[model samples]
Target: MRGARRVPRRRVIQRLVAGMTVGVLTTAIVFAAMGWFPFSALRPREVQVAETARIAALPTTIGFHDPDSYFMNDADVNQTFDKMLATGVKNVRLMMPWAGAEPVQNQFDWTNIDRTVNAAAARNMAVVGIINASPQWAVAPGVPAISGRPASPAQYADFCAKVAARYKGKVSAYEVWNEPNGAQFFAPQPDAPGYTELLKAAYPKIKAADPNTTVIGGVVGSVTDWGTWLVNPVSFVQQMYDSGAKNFMDALSFHPYHYTLKFSDGMAVANSPLDQTVALRRIMIANGDASKKIWATEYGEPMTATDEAGQAAYIADLLTKWQEMPYTGPIMIHTTRDRQTGSTDPENVFGVYRTDWTAKPAQVVMKDAIAAGIPKSPEFQRFSAITDPSYGEVLTPVYRATPTVWAQARTVSTLFETPTGIIASPTAVADKARQFGGIPKTPFQNGYQDFDLPSGMRIWWSPATGAHAVGGGFVQAWVPQLGMALTDEVRDGWSTKVTFEHGYITWMPWVGFQVTMT
Candidate 1:
């Protein structure tokens, strides 16, 4: 009691208060600084999709969402996916409404969701499960229990954890919410902070439940709407990054709906769906989320396209352009069938099929695109856009693969892309590289990747050379011997000549001049 007298309570309290104050100030400063660039660019130019304007030949069985899957009977659900499979759809996106999944606090109901996921799994299709919209019991008194922000982030996280734990391996990915940037989707007002909070909460819960399940942030809508009624798409996303959103999402999602006749336009337009993707990706790159891919989760031209045939054409065009995007994976075309054809709401007409599940002209084009292994116009010429894979090895320069093979493995994140995108089947590349009697390396580096196969060969891809083998016998014998990967591609009268390497390989009308070697 003499030497170690009781500490002064006032001094102890003062120290604690000072520390807390400093911590709060430091956090405030960081958050403020993060918003500097964003606040400055409140109204910026719509990002243009220049080099990224090329289209790809996506597999026919792309992923589609069922707007009413939760309410649909088992028979209807089965028929929907079955019809999808028959038409080449390999994946589906289903919703696990927080309200329905756990109606009474802890009384979780996994029955409907379980059936949806298991049904897809049985069809060998993947499912992208989503969790959002708070329940009435969980939210504040008389809050209307909308499909927007929850009672709190914790409640949303708890719900997500339950969904993740229950579905674990069945669901391929989990999107935080639908369209948080839209007032209609997020409710009250589009609060970017609240959405970020939701992601911050839900991402970890889903990951903790199953690390393999991909966690995507809330899907975003059009970025070029002039930032009037709702949050600016780019700004909303920028705020998300500033608020430490990158740490929370495995991938970014966007819905690039073209409002008017711009549906058939090229990606160069500011409002082009492809342009929207390119712009969003630019934001990702600037915000240090370039490692993450952008999925055009929902995009389509509604049946407002005058005639039913016009709607079909719009679907084909939109799908074609999006499939070409290098930054995208599993590009979904909204829905398989129109949800509200009988209602006055035009939004219900985005489906490729009628409400009765009958195929529209667009649906027919889709099926044909899948069957032909490329996007082909049923009425127009059958264009061989992506290379004919049947030719053992389709040797073409990057320029030759333009419009179809613009981006490949290096810009890739999904297995689907790794197989059919730029490199055009890593399997075939690996097998061929092995035949060359050389140990191959993983496709690494930036943007497009280079593969170092045995026998002094390097898989180099530039805008000029496209993607080709340089310096080795693997490219030497093309026709007679076979199994060779030659940049035998030529465009604009400049077919790839297997001349002894001296400099950059180039062609006109596609990839411009860039660095190369001899």
Candidate 2:
């Protein structure tokens, strides 16, 4: 399976050094006197989307919204991930139940997240980390439900920063909150302004942590049935832009799951995507956000257990329809495996595979589609098995997880400096450390840090010369293969520098910094 290549230590240092320059990755960032960054200081840079491509990447790394991602143990995580890879799907949309990860204020348990992310990385899969729900402690004081909005949007935003810092490279995309249009996820009521406030707060923080990580907004639930709990998503999303939602998102996420609608229905649902989603796009186009992509965040049809052929038909139909749409990116099915042990649960029927991890016709369809490069197929308007009451049943799912490690307390003080500065977390620096050959012998001091590469050659950071990390362009492509920094950050006028065995890398303001060979 093709996975992300691990850059050699020499190459890692080389790239950072090569790419390390002001205005490349981001405007050279500066820390406040007390190392505190106000939200204003963290305003998210506009997202940079890749060119629209055929099939959204070869073999189409279709996204799958894995169910109960938070509850899985390590073994089950691996099992589930392997199954997904087998289906030719390499991108996953996972729920990061915020309350579970952060039961206590300012404290986080990364055990499950670590497993989930590392598992995906090991398989060369990219993950979309969806931060969801309000932590009980952070819920609005007057609101009684745990699902209520946070007491302060900043609190949520800060939490988002911490998550992004921790999983910068491993998780490439983030959705601020899920399905705010659906009252169930947002609770109390779906408040567009409230969700907008959250986006406003979190957007800059996540972007500040890693500008390359895709930040998606308008995580709207598909509008089908309407009640006090639901509003027209199309109308609601337009309200988001009215609330100035465009400033924060790089892409828009749409969950067009009209559970009762036929798969062949496409985005043509009467009150749903055909109307609302289309309107949402027009809002983007009107607002000059045409370059932003639209993601089918979650779309799946429920059927009786015996409706294998029906499920297969839906998959075929969705792939063809989705491929034909230019702006639509990542058709993430609602699931990978059945979620229940019995047919009594409607959710169980959404998986491409049966509960036992055995291939259903849907699974076969998925495999064949991947192999055949998703050729056009007939769409399904109806599945007969769904109408039949005799076919519903479920088997015990395979691969139960027995987690060996659970999350424990970890703090920001545990973090280390990265090419960016002291702000990048230790975990985010893990790969850099690996690629740099070894950890720095000297502790990071002042504003600079160093690494010990092989061959007596070293690399360092300075206010005069940026580290080797370039933003998304040329600097990334240019660098000396390997070296290490032997010294900590040392102040130099208004900037700083780190001394490597080879030379000094400096960082200042607009002029940036430069490297001088010893």
Candidate 3:
């Protein structure tokens, strides 16, 4: 059942890896690197919102995860790109299979990939190349050799670096290993730290190769948690963040396959795959990374037992639902063409086009949906203090449409309830009354905000550091200092540091906080 573009049913696949268990944590790397700098303060004596903060919007676009361009003839590939252009597609996710690219150690064959990248680039389509499929030499002894990860993170990192360097301006983004949460793609068992290692090692090299290209992490598996071999998107993402994944990757990628359910079916009803993103959003928010985007790299419905029109309706509904999720980036439809026609298996038919290259009802639905444009979710204003206020400063400047909305919406919906616990704020500020564990004792002054927690700790925020709790040992350490926290605790490579108006505190992994004065 595991052919070119199809994945087996979750129920059936889980039984295959039945007694398997995921390694909860990977070994934390302690680098003996040497680099430090003096605190050049960002908190001005008199702060202004315009000078200190900015907000930009992320617009949604539709694309495809098709293999025609990679395996088809040159003329056929050009035709495929032309069809995509005609369908109003703006993005494409192509595979840069590591096994096929580098069969021998340090040796490479860029034939199919170069063709795919060049074709997409020629048509002005954005390409997100997924770097996966480990080769024989790269896989360690006894690891499930097929689609297994390289034994060392450096090997995968090197391959990713080469792809970035080769496709410099062509590839818009790179998805680091597809569905590592599933044993099918990751092999043996899923490991969060192992995946994080690949990201940590590849991220810097990818950035060094092409700073403009986005490095997407967390290409999680199916919607719900069925077994240890296939971790749920939410749990896997949480584990990734725990393993220091936040510092790496430009955006988080996911495959929210909703099976037979309609996107309109609420989370409680469908066990909604799209709503699953809200949980991932919460993880990002709690980790001080609400600003980043979550990409739906693969999603679609199969036309096996269902009516073609019903499949089209499913796609149409998905498009409408995704527009309300502001945190979502581009959505790549599973495949452009069907793997087989008249096949009883649902896995072989997740395509908008038939095997004969004829357009299906879903294709027309997709074209119309893209033409209509996507809107910002209504809840976009809720997390403005943590996400919106610093948008332009943190990420690259992308053109957002009118009305100035923030990227994500669902995470802080509950936190923004009123004093009476009723109306939510139309304007964005830090979380409302009860969220800081206490009521805000200060007014919103020119993009700065704070609240006193019940634990006697204070929550401070800045455009540079979002929102962070300054309490306990850090507060005890700060009580003897000259001024309040000017910035939140931040991690740079190996060490964690926070700056005050007069001095700062730095903490290493094993070593606790070290206080330093200006």
Candidate 4:
């Protein structure tokens, strides 16, 4: 007896039985929750399809920066034109320098111009010839020399009429001026009066020559405080409207360049172009032009040599978001080729293609993005999972679990049971949960437990608490230790029989409950 050791056989048996009970109960509970159990009397109803508005076809136009320069060498111009055609580009915005086209009074040279048109047409790309800048003949003889400001309204109108008549049928659209709000282009005086006069004179001639062609005005440069230059885009638009010039144009064009005062410094904030575009849209809506569409005539992301990838991602996201908006129409990236000067702007790195005719990584990404359609962001994906239940098989309640609480969180996962014999944190349980569909609410805490009930059914613990859970259903949870957060959650129908350890808080308005039967 002294040599024999005593053993707790009953305790060992009890522990084994408890472990077996948890295993069996978990399987039964999962089956019950999934409506697979024979005793399951309730089933989740099918999720409703969300209403999505049909998006209009977005215009794909590439800015042909300094066409005058590109066409300088016939061989180079022909090669570039052929390449553009091969790229599947359907449209080009060609900058037609008023000074260059009409260098001498009433003396017009259409040699290079005809070459450009014929070349583009051969590739089947529609041309949007932008007439900008003033020659010495059109302006005051002794007026200060500037870049794009036209000299006289009458001369500018005459030049526009000639351009319209020459390319009436071939050109798709005509933009009257470029960055008229900027001192660099519309300088001497950046006032809207001069611009309105130019539009009034040019729009009629364009329409008269070719009724099929579209004439657009207001190629206002960036969203700067135009007031500083004695011109506000909103006010300028109003002036144009008041001047009866609004009806003359088919679309309103704007550059919307998010130019940083940093002068190509690497530290400038990105998304400036998008922000300016939104502001322009708001201005248009505020001014009673809701029906009119906006054309981003010259939008771009100027990236530093090292930040090309970031630039590509930014461009992709911007274009995708732009396509989603209702009023947005036609966005033309600034340039097809890098500036010859290797500068960050005008001669800077905004070109999608390198000077050597190689496609920049950004260019490749852009082409891929356009061909692949809008990219789905992670935020959008999570939102969709919460709002679209039929999109996947996982229960919404199980999909929304916090990743820190659940180690099984994957791109997709299904929840089946609660851990009792095997202790799992709340975050671990939530990481395996599916998110509920529809608009997202606040976050809450959830707990899991199990109970053996009558009818061979088991009651599984499913409880939620927190800011999101306060409104009901699955709530997002945050675990600071893991530096992880649960974006969404769903309370599966199986949880109906199980009592919550902690009651959920209701912060949102009460929506009627949906019951399902299988």
Candidate 5:
């Protein structure tokens, strides 16, 4: 409804380019030579440099949705931009409300948006604009009178074209609409085909107006219809593709508000934003659109219910995971300042700063991440292969992977504790190290060492035994009935044995593991 503030749905609680100076190009080449780069310099010079910088510039991994920046007083606006810059924010996401700018069919006022865009430009910060809110005149007759959808797709296209034309050089990208999958934002009841029509109409027009501007589509919210308020985001994205939305936009965007769910929960739980994003990627891959990136345009926790420290930790965790995903792009936090300092409403407290402009723990975390250049590294977590049917393959980031021996320390203490540090393994044993996890830890005793796996399994190695995985239900049964293994696995013709602190477990070729408690 037009009556509501453009706050995000109540439920769920949930890149720069240009100015590639010669010096930066030189730096890019130098980094490439040292094996640190967006691309290898194995290609032609012109194409290599441009593509490299463009890749590096992408995903704009650390931006904030500073809607308040559009309405701030001149002094506050300048101050806010300064704060954002000091924290290393590479870009700012602004709300370009269509209704406010185009109230009466083409009669336009760009005062607020102009101020915000100009402020960001003055500081050399890129701007990603959210073009939303349909004016009353644009709503088609008999439409459900929802707040942000226009009557005809062309009406929205016209506005997008106008915006792209007006701020061609200043704005870097535009999101078609915000959360159109939610009845709260779209009209005629959250129809994917309907939203795709808008994207199909607007993409070409916006490109024609400003060819360099990126048009991001599929701005769906992370929600499912509990009743009639929302459409399942994963299914909605597929519907968009079915409606031929694949070629209409440069990239797809979604709001990944976790609400009460933690980032870890998203990794393991079924319908989390992270899980949904994976499903959406699968959909894209199946449609042969695998190269397209999925941007998390809005993500954050409201401090009213989630503690400040908790918000910082979750955001940090989310950023690390985002960096690990090759298909992901920028992850923009919801807002810049609390809408009201002490309001109980979650929307009012999503900001990393209080309304009075004091910093929160989340702001500090953002500052540190930006300063670190948002490095890409594995999260020392249980990894899942995108193609694995049962989660066995170990996936390491191309760069900054944890050292094999040290990485095994996550589950096994002996590896990090033993003085027999970094013993060499035989070629046969080393070849299958990844199957266990990383390199083997030092031999815990005279002739035996262990390799820990991400799946909580361990591989025991000895001159006599060579190497073999010893885990699964057998290990589960062994740990309770017996204690930690006291000796490496010993094999005789047809059986295997491992002595534990209080007992022993014997394995027969056909009979599996049998434990004997002392």
Candidate 6:
């Protein structure tokens, strides 16, 4: 019995040993296959600053046929000036009637102009005086009354020189003529020959008077295909460039009035103001004059007694759009107050203010838009602060304002900042974080995390729990509202709990949290 029990114990021991060895080998193989014993390497780190680009200028101006006549008295002028200054406007555009200045040959009456200039200067606003109108002495005695029409290029040059010399530094910029391509004043010309000649002669005179002053070409009217050849703004501009008129002016100016239609309709026409600008830019680029900027000297949609809200919306849209386009410079709405003349069309009511100088709804809307920041999409954002309360009253011959919100957002989208090795502020860090998540939020509520985990380790985040549940991450952990897909890892979270707060939970998906395992 003892011999039989000993033999059985040896076989059992051999079998147990073999079973233990196989189990250990299988566990080792499984660990090796899963690569669980090896360390994972962290990805390369890239940091970027999310700042908006400097957008195009928003210079607002007032179009005044005659400031003295329109305002009536010195008190009225002063009142208007005060209002304009309140709007954060820096420029005004006034048409210096050639006839009014030189009613008699060589006799210049600078009384009204001097008063206007002094008033504007006191308010710290620059003037862009457009020398227009034809004096009876300069034109054929029988020629119908219009803006100045000098008989010859030499005559025009002389008048321009005189005006430029008188104003000198007081006037920041000068325009040679108004609408030369139109039959209104620059009548009877082959293309823009008459206008080009006038520019060539006046350009030197203007420079001679005041080298510091900028000279802009007169604002052309229509550029539509249906427009007459003489009034075809595009043709006139092309011809002017062909004739070496580009070297004369600091900026090319034009009137982009979209008539009575809504802002969207005006934007839609084939050869509308915006489209014409694209064509102008191409021409400027083609002519190697890319440095020259285009100015919309006169632009606005007419408001009516019945449709004030529509007018307000149109103005808001126009300003917002202007803020977004990088090439658009200054935009001067046609008139600050509705005029008695010019047109009897009830739709000719383009006044931002009523006749009594009180602001219209459109005026309030503009102030609000500028104050809140011009929205990029009319559907998304609000206006900025009212930097100027009397923006409706004062004529800014050369007004320059800041870009709207829409412009700012677009700028941020394309913005890239080179590292300067400077420590970033809390606000700056928050901004960057928001940008990374494709969600915009105020800097105060930005969420962040810090970690000190070991190197050569990767961190991942998910709404799920347990091992191997990493890849099936939910965008709910990322973008809670817009339902965006997670395609990229935004940042590395250190040994800190990142808690996002408020509307930020779903509102700003641009920030999130994750932890690393060593």
Models 1 onward score TM values of: 0.60, 0.60, 0.64, 0.58, 0.65, 0.58
Ranking by TM-score: 5, 3, 2, 1, 6, 4
TM-score of 1: 0.60
lDDT of 1 by residue, 130-153 (tens): 676555465554344434357688
Count clashes in each candidate, considering only residues at least 3 apart in sequence or on different chains.
8, 33, 0, 34, 1, 34
Compare candidates 4 and 5 on lDDT and give the better one. Answer: 5
- Model 1 segments beyond 4 Å from truth? 1-61, 223-228, 262-272, 340-343, 375-518
**Candidate 2: where is the Cα deviation over 4 Å?**
1-60, 142-146, 224-227, 266-269, 376-518
Q: Where is model 5 more than 4 Å wrong at Cα? A: 1-60, 142-146, 375-518
For candidate 5, lDDT tens digit of each residue in 10-63? 421110112212233443443333222324222212111111011122543688
Q: lDDT of candidate 4 vs native?
A: 0.49
- lDDT for 305 in candidate 2 is 29
In candidate 3, the residue pairs with backbone N, CA or C atoms under 3 Å apart (3 or more residues apart, or in different chains) clash, namely none
Q: For residues 1-518, could you state the per-residue lDDT of candidate 2 as single tens digits?
A: 00211111110001112222223112122111111122233332222222211224222447678845546778888888899889887788776656545544554555556667777777777788888656556775545323556768998898899788777766778898887776666757788888899999999999999777888888886664356577667777778888999889988988755444443342222453433555576678778887787787777656652366776776666666555444566778867887763575556567777789887777777777767777633211112112222222111011001121111001111122223332221322322343433444345454333443443322334435434322212122224532444454567798767555566667677856666667
Per-residue error at 46 for model 5, in Å?
A: 36
RMSD of 1: 19.8
Give candidate 4's error at residue 304 in angstroms.
Answer: 3.7
Better of 5 and 6 by lDDT: 5
**Higher-TM-score candidate among 3 and 6?**
3
Give one digit per residue, the lDDT tens place, for model 3 in 1-518: 11122243432112223332222111000000100001232121221111111111133578888744555668878877777877888688887877555554554556667767777766777788888876656777766433567798998898889888777777778889888888777877788889999999999999999898888999885545546666777888898999999999888987777656665443323224644666677688789887788887888888864789988887776676665555677788877877686788776687788889799999998888778775333443333344444222222111111123222223222222334332222122333222333334444444334444544555554545455556445665664453546665577999878787678988787888788999
